[model samples]
Target: MRFFKLFFVLLLYGLSLLVLPPVSSSEVVWSISARVGDNVTLPCEAPGVVDFEDVAVKWTRPDLGPDQFVVFYRDGRPDPDNQHPSYQDRVDLVHSQLMGGDLSVVLKNVTINDSGRFECQLIQKMENQKKWSESKPISTIVLKVSDPDPIEARVGDNVTLPCNTSDVVNFEDPTVKWTRPDLGLGQYIYLYRDGRPDPENQHPSYEDRVDLVHSQLMGGDLSVVLKNVTINDSGTFECHLIQTMMFGKRRKRSRSESELLSTIVLKVSDPGSTGNRTETGDEGGHEDRQRHGLTGSVCVVTVLSVGLFLSKKAKLSKSF
Candidate 1:
């Protein structure tokens, strides 16, 4: 039978390459968490590979000190000659998908020491043999160093809540508290020493309402300015970080607390009115002011115009 059908198609193509199943390569799948100008996305998942679109991509940092290449490429041609000037221009390598090898990466304006640990590399060259496709073991993104975003005023509207902790340079002076829980009292607006603004221990309804307080206990600009906001101000605010933990030295001094809230929801207008309607409050304030008063929107529009002209004169005297 034609030599048993050509040896049964070469033993079914070598038993389908020994039952196939083998394509596990491509790391640094995805990992991201940021805050500092905010703009990040790094995901690289290569598999089985096929025409690596002229491979050659590198982004390193091997964990701070040493191996901080940052950027590099050759095949796809993008090797700023061995890039490293602190990642000139901030770093970028997302060449339109590069034939699906996807070496995604994008960073900019983030400051908090730029947080660390990042590596996405791939180098594959044919024609002779030059292979290397790595991905996992290294792919970490953390830029938690924060301070910014907390400002919304109304009442008397005179805000300057600039609690922008400029990427902390470590001088220690970030424990500013402010809360107006239903007007019960919870002050102490500013206390940043060594750089100014330490009004004794301030908190007499904001003593002077704080202003232009330039604080930088090393780099955290804990700004403050709340000129006039009424309606009993508002609540819920936090600006984290207060550390002091050094095990193995009999020492511990930690304190990470960041809270901010200067809300003022108060806009008043009416009060006391038999039933002509007008009672705004869920914060639009209105009730109070009943100092022996009763609203009279023009006597409720002349008693609904004399009860609609006596019901049209009793319906024309019952239609005559």
Candidate 2:
């Protein structure tokens, strides 16, 4: 009976090893998009992290220059020997979440230079076991950076709306679209393709007012200039691009629709009386005087006071 019991225990242990999976086989990937100056959290966790306080976790950014050590942990504390200087005070781990199989880190004050792929690796140590099993990439986070701030402009003045690409642009078969949500769909402010504006599909209000003033579309400049802007032009403007690429030895053509390169807010303000004050004319002066309640009677009283003082001075000189 003792021999049988020992053999049974060995059999169970052998079966457990066969059923257990490798750490490298399990990995999670997540995509994150954020604007400039934002705080983001990158998650990394595994079911195997339960009850393992001694875990080795390291985050790295291979795309960025020089420094790759984003965060490194060993024996329950962070190691700062090879940490990147740019991420020194900006990166931190959540210990509460880490206890629950989560190795997530919160990055503060994110900048455009921080945009790239981030990899998280973890290894949990068994309590009674001498050997530690390292977990593969628990998470692969891709951070895409963009700037979505509004651009201010004044009415009756020309304004340039900026939108450009970081990659090479093919202008031969390019499609650029500028649309405003307030104007509804299909009523684009400007539509350019094959090197010319598509006036047939353009909105009548922006018929001759919109132009691709960049003059260097092929050089990757997609900025547009609006001439004689109106108050109605104030709204969100989206710039979409679609380009064709030739690939492979056969030179097969492929079309890839680009994401909205940028969405610019056009804030159109009326020139108002403030701007009209610059005109050098009597009408402008008269309007300004009325606005400030500077009546003609106040000016006449000042002139009479000066004349009375002059008459008194002549009488005093004769007496002397």
Candidate 3:
């Protein structure tokens, strides 16, 4: 019995090494980053202790105050009425996945007015207890304003936008998605991941008209091709990407680091629609348009197309 007891104690001690450490009162762990006026997330992805109904969650902007808060969840409830005035409507919990350690905060309409550091704190106590206990970690959240590159395209025409990465070891897996912000959130004109088109997230209007533009991690080209464009297709397009491991990427990537690159403001314009309409009749249209003296600035052949150009996004992200 004595030997068995000793073995059990030793095993218990060893197992403790595998468990997550208890958070300390001095440490703070929550991160947020964003461009001015852009939505940002301050994530406090830390594991939680389950079944503790009396436990509480608190959010405070340390730079703003010692106890000032954007919001807080306590005693299994939220206190929005008592939330900090400035963050009353802007702060939200994406950390409902907190049980898995995801304590993320999503902030919308991010602007210069929303600049600062955020903290996520966990407090707990039994209903019968009068005192509350709290824990924290070492993490800081910061925000920055970003202006992505602009790309334009036209319907029935091909538009190319690149998802360039600065330094990736090897693109063993690559994903390219073209998004039409005009379609609202979570909408896609075309998406390609791992070199395959994802029909699951396809936009009905883009059916059969989208294709991969081109990709070569070595050169940081992840451009997607959109064909048979439409007027409604014009809007902001973001080039999303993720790195894939390749065989010879180490040495090559060591010279370069894996990085996420994006460009926004992809506009799809109506081709020749902006110009004066020539009477339609293949020969008549062509002859009349010319005879009518339609040329130069008047004939823009205007269509939305996005490519590697001196765009504001590149300048903002310092890609170029």
TM of each candidate vs. truth: 0.30, 0.44, 0.37
For model 3, residues 289-308, the per-residue Cα lDDT tens digits are 78667654354433222333
Best by lDDT: 2
The better-scoring model by lDDT among 1 and 3 is 3
How many residue pairs clash in each candidate at the backbone level? 17, 0, 27
Q: Residue 283 CA error for candidate 2 (Å)? A: 17
Deviating ranges (above 4 Å) for candidate 2: 1-147, 245-256, 273-320
- The CA lDDT of each predicted structure is 0.53, 0.78, 0.61
Task: Compose the digit string of candidate 2's lDDT tens values, residues 61-153.
Answer: 876556458987776677787788778756788774367777889776566777898989876666775656655677899988776576777
Candidate 3 Cα misplacement greater than 4 A, ranges: 1-149, 182-187, 215-218, 243-260, 272-274, 277-320
Off by over 4 Å in 1: 2-8, 11-22, 25-36, 39-88, 91-121, 125-150, 155-212, 215-218, 222-320
